[model samples]
Target: MTPDDLADSELPMLSAAQATHLRALAAPHYREGHQYSLESLAHTCSRAPEEHWPDLVAAHFDRLRQASQGDESAEELLRGVHARLLPVDSVPSELLGSLRYARVVADGLVFAYALDGPTSVRLLTDRDVERAGLQALGEAARANLMRVPVRHEEVGVEGGARLRSVYGDSPFVAGQALFLAEVAWKVVGERLPDAGALVVVPTRHNLVYHPIADGSVVDAVNSLAAYALGAHEDGPGALSPRVYWWHRGSLTSLTVIDHETLTFSLQPPPHLLGLMKGLVHLDRAGRLATRAAAEPAGLEELMRGAAESMDRLVQDPATLADAFRSLVSLAHARCAYDPDVAHIDTWDAWATATRLGSALFTGAPAQECHLGEDLVWQLPAFPAEPPADARGWLDALYLAIVCRQTDRIGRLCRVPSETLRQDDSVDEYVLHWIDTLRAYFSDGPSMDDVVEKLVATIETSGRDGVTHAPTEFVNAIDYQPAALFHRLIARDHDTFAKALAEAVAEHGGYWDGSAAPRARVALGPLAMASLAYDYGFPVDPAQPCLPAHLLNRQRLEEFS
Candidate 1:
């Protein structure tokens, strides 16, 4: 009988002709009732195509017959055994004696030990567990499960929640959630909040989790629950359709199922609710403080407020890097546009950002870039690796080159242009600018090639009037390369000066009526001018975007 015939019947039973065929295909050692029950045969047939039913049934019976004899020694069995998670009530009462060693780990889930083979998985029986010793077997299973290689990726969920998914083709992937704490530390490190995380093991090959941080936990719970149900239903080795709270190494079910209605919903316990509420309150407070700091104000006051509120405003390494970029932008704006703002004030902001960035990214303290303290090119221990975000890496490379720090520039260049292209958010023009700077600094390509690429980008961007960069940043992205190429490679002082003025105007327009300190400067133009001034290009000290005090580099000479 076909699979559809079995599905339409009240009892999934094989017909006489099908039974005869299955019996003929059975292994020589297969016993009729013990190793090849009619019910088991029907179930296997329903899940596989009729064309391959013979081989499948033959292999299934052979596996059962081999498992029944238990020829392998306990030591050999322990080597391949691993923890397996199964749906609740999946084991029949008659087979319960064999799986008595299994324990309930969470709602709708049973954790059991199994010997994973190339072609099949054999669930350990109570007799096998007794011989291996429960403690030794448990340890061996966990160790074996952990050995499986898993890939990690971060995905953004709706409502501003981020989920980390760890998956593998191995059948024991879901069981790794049993040791979620260790995995969280290995993958998340300092990013995992003190409150722990929300977790879901949907199928034998997938586990997704969100580190509990703020009010977004509510959205994360709903998203994870929906994902779990869908993945479980589509699974080759389905495990659970429930969400669980993983707190301090403990897993508790967060899903509540209505048996009568056959539906499920997530409901966090009181303790978890209280924790989430507290995080929500803090999140709101931090946002309010950031808003206050962004109000119309003097650059120094705004910088001071930002530095003070950083701990509350920044949540992760990514945000910390962004905060540093914001501060750098503000320092550039102040130096370029606000002549009244002291160069020392701009240096102070840079020093503060560098210190915070160093602490966060490198776990090192940076020496203060004080006024008249000869610029120490290497005082701050830069992060060994560049930021993964294309924009952040660009900002870092700009700072390194403008400061004339060869070591820092070399470190940043280790990241190839192709790696930066992976971030789709960055504009093509911005990437071209990065490539030009990398090639120029490293002497990797001819200056003519760089100029040709820059001119082509400018022509294309001007013709299309379209850019991949965000609306607020399009002008800055367009103007940075033009200004840098003119000053550095073309040696066209007049063109460089014009490009600088346009960049300054674009910066002002972008930050018009904004109270944030970063609105005061155009960092890209200032960096380009710094390079020109160093190269003895007669830059107009009174230029709108090039602050004279900063161009002199007297402060930078203090370290010398």
Candidate 2:
């Protein structure tokens, strides 16, 4: 530990290639201000008896030399080195009492087994590690072992390794987790008591732990992950974004945050999340059975309560509402300089706010609505236009529309008792808005012209007392006429013709002689003339707007 010892240390000498590789591997640690010397790193490598020292150093340096520029291959190469030299899991009876040790050697990794009889360290070879099936274990050990000194306080002992700290000074990277899990299994396994270990990751870097129940090793690990996610700090980077159940050398299960937005948007999966929340809440409330396993009766009752609450949350709509409200509030706070909607709660309030939220929050399309799932059942009637009432169904509907949730939009579209009202065409308006959104947001067409033509068509139809036909005609072809006409107005006749041809093809050839051969065959001339007039393009009188139909009729005559 002293400078004199460091100077006197007889460490492994590295070949030119090995030294270069070590330098490259050590670059990151050096950049982060870790000044590790070859001798120091060598000392840290698994200690071995004098006779085995040379081979161990050589193997350790060889491992370093094999690493690529970025050490991306560090794990694989290190594992190879260990597999070659370490005793396999199926070892001779004589070696049963020995213990294997893993350590980071400067930029490299090293392993050695201490013989029980002689109390001497025997360096492991690559072949030995492979035979032992200890590659994953080695990888885990090397990765999780802290390179930097962490401010740690040992909380407990599990298996052979000590529970060093509840939370680490920094966040666990993707691979360190594998090591932690491996170590946990090695040390804790099924011996973990009923009060599961509590692992709290306030940030990706820091993790805190306490015992909440007595359980097996795997259960304890699972509980730790669940608690980390449910109980961590709020907002991005403040909390662990996700947690995983690590066992058998890899992560088997992980529950992500933002279940609704990220997984199932229409409905969030509540069971696992509820279980997670239940445990964390129990910890927070001091209601857990004991610091370890709960007394049988008390633990059972508490668990029953947790289960009931989870089921109730799944069945109740209130949980959904609360989660959405929180997320919307967060979004609003994020947009502090220019928030579109004020925070509103309660079913009635959200109804009216849905409309305002849609209009004001029109920064970009969101993936999900802030309105809760309960809004669907308690939805009030929507007036012809979006009502001022926050409780009206249109409020939620508008928000869904603006958020660009097509599936939710479809669901909301069916929720209204009456699809239309006096002077207000609810379905038509929704369809129109969806088109406007797709066009504007996707950059498929000009928004100004699309809106202008749609407005003109609606106004013209209203003035002419042509109720529903214009809208129906527009919807039948899936909102392409306006876009086509916009092109036509720009004197892009070629594009218009090409688009029209493709549209007809998609709807089946116009003269198929079916009841609805063309999607809007009955209103072909009217729809064409309406678009032409709206955009200031003159309709060609001699041309048959229903070209396929005209051609088919002539073909029939010729056959006859």
Candidate 3:
């Protein structure tokens, strides 16, 4: 979707449909094998000649990243941006989960919009009673006469009159908590969509679902619901709702991750950090509990134990690693989808290695994912402060800890880019992860998954015996040009399906049986022996987490 398409869609801001089209248009530009540099991205997205725009992004994402790092005033500007950009339920995730902090003005606006029950659940607060439940949360919020207007019809009724609303402008962390919980609460109850490698977490930060009235109210006041939309923002203010200060460092931001690309202070307030941690624990517990309750008695027991195993982190390091790793992978998939993340920072290298990718292999049609609700609800105009879109701020944190494919997404997410933040070590782990996958795919037995696809790439080879890997290429893996076409550029179902069929036909039998690798393939371990050499994880039989099994077994029994 061209910017023109976006403008024509009458979307408040970037819609799901337009974004998908733009993604298709930009797909050909992501040539990792040719080492497509940032220098040429502009041509891929611009109407102007390649020489004119020079960069794909508008230079605003960087500015916002900078301002988020340097200026206190930028916090408010960031909030203002959220006010503009997140004007509706259109934010990449739930109302306010973790990407950024909020100021009073943004809070007020969010509350007013939410009071009408736009996209938000009730405003979370530690004070609300969990016993009150969703119904109660709604009732309490409704019963209290907020000075802000409710719906116009309700506003006119008796005692529906305005009262001095108590808007709590807490620390950045508090704002983050509210965002996560609101989003989480909403997600936990809904039938979430099947996002590829995506996790639609309703709760993030340390916020969890607490039943205590005060806890509930606090959750309400200081919570944000979240979703991880797959969007990229490397082109400066690509993260910005407003074009002017998008990445300008002057427009919006409370905190910026993906630290390496720009400068920023990573010092979150101690309380905020603690609060976030607490909320996260709560969220994990809730997920575990919910999953267990909804599941069969046996697995429920296991999940219960897993949830309770937080107590075992110090005593059971291996168990902790397994649990954490699982969580990390889930988070990584979502980070890929989050719109606010600088694409350059958040996308996996595999994502950039476009010479052999299937851009539309799994995506819905271009016409389906239209512009979002944000332009009206959230984003502001160019030069205007963008609504604070905290999806980047929060999700990137999870991406770092969970995806651990740090080298791939860290710089893109901005976490490693920060000179001030320590060696987050996120890359350290993710690199280890890539090696693990490489080894597993190489030396290990082939499963039913990628074998056929691998053979297809080889079979479909052109005269040079060079055919693209299903989602990657050989020579291109080493370097890439300014831009190259990938599969699925036609923006149609037939094209997507046909390319998938061809790729599958040629390579679909690599794992027809238990035979590991006759030769090198994308998921091959031999292709990544160096990776296995660097960091070790169990291969083949899948190593054991003995303690996890024992403790988790016990915990599940209790729940059962």
Which regions of candidate 2 fall more than 4 Å away from where they truly are? 1-107, 110-118, 125-179, 184-345, 352-357, 360-560
CA-only RMSD, every prediction = 20.9, 23.4, 30.0
lDDT of 3 by residue, 1-560 (tens): 54544532222234445435444444454434221122123324444443333243434223322332212232222222211122233343432443233222321123221122212122322222232343444334333322222111101112111111111221111122223222322433322111000111121111122221111212222221111111112221122211010110112222334537643223333333333343333333221112212221232343344334323532443343233323223222223243222333223221211100111111111111101121111111112111121212222222222223334233333322222122221112222222222222343435332333333333333223321111122222211100010221223444433433333323223222211111112112111221222234221211111111111122111100
On residues 1-560, what C-alpha lDDT tens digit does candidate 2 reach at each position?
43433322123233344444444544543323222235334343324444454555566555544433222243443432311111122233343333334432111112242111112113343444454446564554354343422344544333212232433433222223334443334433422222223343434344444332211232444445544545432312243334333322332224443535643111113332333333443232222212232122232343234334323433553333232232222222222221222223222222323333332222113222223333222222222332221112332443343333444444444332333232132224334433433443343467675666466544443313322222222333334444454455566656666655554544333223222112222222323333443344543323322322222222111100
Instruction: Please name the candidate that would achieve the greatest TM-score relative to the true structure.
Output: 1
As a TM-score, model 3 comes out at 0.18
* TM-scores of the candidates in the order shown: 0.48, 0.21, 0.18
lDDT of each: 0.63, 0.34, 0.24
Better of 1 and 3 by TM-score: 1
Residue 511, model 2: Cα distance from true site in angstroms: 57
Which structure is stronger by lDDT: 1 or 2? 1
lDDT of 1 by residue, 113-150 (tens): 88987556777888888889999999999889888888
Best by lDDT: 1
Model 1: which ten-residue window has the lowest total lDDT? 285-294
